[model samples]
Target: MDKNLLGNNVIAQIGILVHDIEKTSQVYAEFFGMMKPEWSLTDAVDKAKTEYKSEPTEARAKLAFFDMGSLQLELIEPDEHPSTWREHLNEHGEGPHHIAFFIKGMEEKVKLLELNGMALTQKGEYTGGRYAYMDTFKELKVMVELLENDN
Candidate 1:
């Protein structure tokens, strides 16, 4: 098998889609014995800075992150917008949606994925970082999200 596109030995954050962030987060916190996570809305994502399938979009979602030692568990409550989160929930129901890896050389990585026939399904900017989701489910059985933190 060819090497993984996301690189080997890099920890990835597990992302899940939920119908209600508060309820799901509460359950996760209780199960993990961690403090309640602070959820953040994706409303601040400028529509002009987002795209879906290479087209402009106004997708949004509610996100909460819980640090679990070296990795994070991300809970996503998607709005009625046209985002990958919403699409995943609609297609797969409440469950794991994607695996995200923080990366450098984002443009190059994106290009490489594109060359390999993976299309970018979603992309947006939030705070100090930008993220792109590649539709790799057909081959990898899961979407791949690349996060670039400029901090």
Candidate 2:
């Protein structure tokens, strides 16, 4: 327990990033009878194929957020382009990718992670959330994301 970092009051938002988002989401839908949460759907269609190039992308994703009473289940699928989903699938096949911890000292924590030798792939803000992606998997492997709700 990181206490002030990932405060104990925060809820768990479990994530599963599959190459085929729909197929994986279906599994949860069957088991828990979970449907997509309306307000949590976010798809990034502008992210580049490899890097954050200026070029447009068909790289899309459908994330279904399922309310599991205490903890929530987030199911993700990449649109076959530049993404953690694509990269993860290329190496490890389909599986649960990252566990996002809700933190308070995001900038400070990022600096600490870098100092400790964790590979930071990208560090930036999205909407109102401040996030840092670090490579914790084998190659350009799984990204351990620290998301701080700046709002």
User: What are the per-model numbers of colliding residue pairs?
Assistant: 0, 0
TM-score of 1: 0.92
lDDT of 2: 0.60
What tens-digit string does per-residue lDDT give for candidate 2 at 85-121? 6666577776777766778788788667666566566
User: For residue 110, what is the lDDT in candidate 1?
Assistant: 84
lDDT of 1 by residue, 13-64 (tens): 9899999999999999999999988998775445338887777677778889
Instruction: Estimate the lDDT of model 1.
Output: 0.84
**Per-model CA lDDT versus the true structure:** 0.84, 0.60
For every candidate, C-alpha RMSD to the true structure in Å: 1.8, 4.8
Q: What is the lDDT of residue 103 in candidate 2?
A: 80
Off by over 4 Å in 1: 43-48
